[model samples]
Target: MRSMTLGLLALTLASACGRNTPRPAARADAPPCHCSHDASAPMAANQPLPDTSVFQMGVPWTDQSGRAFDLASLAGSPTVVLMFYGTCQSTCPLLVRDVKRVEAALSPAARARTRFLLVTFDPSTDTPERLSALAAEDHLDLSRWTLLRGADHDIRTFATVLGVQFSRVGPGEYTHSNLITLLDPQGVVATQLEGLQQPVEEFARRIEGYTR
Candidate 1:
């Protein structure tokens, strides 16, 4: 009779143990076990950028308005690009004037379609405040103009791609080749004018062609 009671007690204990044993916790690195769709999650839907475009460099830049963006953000517009230091006394001002001349030559419709980008080699000095001051002094139309500043390495890489050569000739001065580059909507170099002497009308026509 005692052996029968012992057997029944063992069976009851075994059943209780089986029911009470907890499952192991999941590992920290393991992926989530989701059972339902996430409606608020963002979908991966971006197309790959072209390999040859400069925007593919993924360099970060800050503009005169203290807004941060990558070069790819300017991808869809026909850009008039040039590199200059804000404190430059010689060719830099001439370059700005030449770009303005091109802007002046554009019709209102064409001007609205074009974007002017000025990247500074002297990022250390050309902070957003300084760029804003310069823009105000030049009466730059902020609606269509963007002044950019990035790291020194990024500046060098940008100049190299545009075939612009620049060096710090003295304190607060830079000696850079006066070249203006026009980029198509795809960020491909459509045309490059080597000096400030190029006719503004020709440059304007090139930009207009791209807009059309």
Candidate 2:
């Protein structure tokens, strides 16, 4: 009976060990995002929607022109902020391709009124010179797709607020989220596209909503 009891205890301990998992604490963003707004909430089901573009991060950094820029930037018109590295192997290119597609679909007047901001996460490698070259290679209009850089801390902060996720595996290589954020002229996140699988028409529609 003692031997049986010992075996049962060992089995229970093994089961408990196998079932253990490190649970993460509730994050600040975990709570449903709500504010005192007369409009509507930005959450649908379990996901966040940009009902109002009031979210802004004041983190500061520099632009491709080597001028100071910040997350709380005020664009002349509403803007679409995108994240990518010059040396990205996959998703980044797809994002740019989709943006171009959207641009092509836009009316000449709409293209003139909207803006795009590309923030580089790998700022150490993507200096102003390299960013310039990459922009040229992609035929990016500096007037529209403005490239920006930030130090690691501020860059991470900006990425977090935009919900852009990334992990560096080696030098100049990263696994990152394929996301694009639409910010209104007032500098609020109007909406965020979490994946690149959506149609360019979808992005165009989203952009129009923000422009209004």
Candidate 3:
């Protein structure tokens, strides 16, 4: 069953993340499905995670604060998740900035209950200390944002679950898909915003519904 779940997800992602061309900046007119869930409702607390939940990976992780972390603990709050390395010279900086824009757009009520999770593709370079330093450099609100790294295999598994393709292109460098995903309170992927430099108002609005 687990293998089947992963297989189906891989197929779904092949279409979503396989595109070589950059997806266009998100517009108000963009398809609603981009910010909507395939499931009709969030799962109840006692319910097992659906096959689509990334939290199903059950991998051990370490956060920027150097604390051991569990992915499932993120349940019960909406989370914004993305994958990137700290030192990338190209799209990573812009991707982080775009996520911040969405964060800034959320109302305090919504923002308080929301979490931002940034996991690194290059775990060897993005140690907890380095992730913390990068967070400080970006002025991330530590109370809400979490930067995480894990063992290489765990990182690969987690990336696969999120449909984020990444590869080490050179020493200290990686190429990765620019995908921002929103997980519902139950940790099921509710929607995604792809590409870079996209408008964030609609994305922010979609997230607000989950917070409330």
Model number with the top lDDT: 3
TM-score between model 1 and native:
0.75
Clashes of each: 0, 0, 0
lDDT of each: 0.77, 0.68, 0.81
Model 2: CA > 4 A from native: 1-56, 71-73, 209-212
Best by TM-score: 3
* lDDT of each residue in 1-212, candidate 2, tens digit only: 54354535665565565436322322344323232241122222333334443334556667777888654444335577788898998888888876677778677776776777888989999998988888899999988778888888977877777778787888999888788776655545655666775666755665555443
Arrange candidates, best TM-score first.
Answer: 3, 1, 2
Global local distance difference test of model 2: 0.68
Question: Cα miss at 78, model 3 (Å)?
Answer: 0.8
lDDT string, candidate 1, 1-212, tens digits: 54354535665666567647542332243222221142123222353544556667888899998899677766666689989999888888889888888899998887897889999999989999999999999899998899999999999999988878888877788878889987765566766777776887766876666565
Candidate 3: clashing pairs of residues: none
lDDT of 3 by residue, 1-212 (tens): 54355535655666577568344432353223322552334446776765666776789999998899898887767889989999899999999998999899999988887899999988889988999999999999999999999998998898777778888889898988899988877676767888898888876877778765
TM-score (C-alpha) between model 3 and the true structure? 0.78
TM-score of each: 0.75, 0.70, 0.78
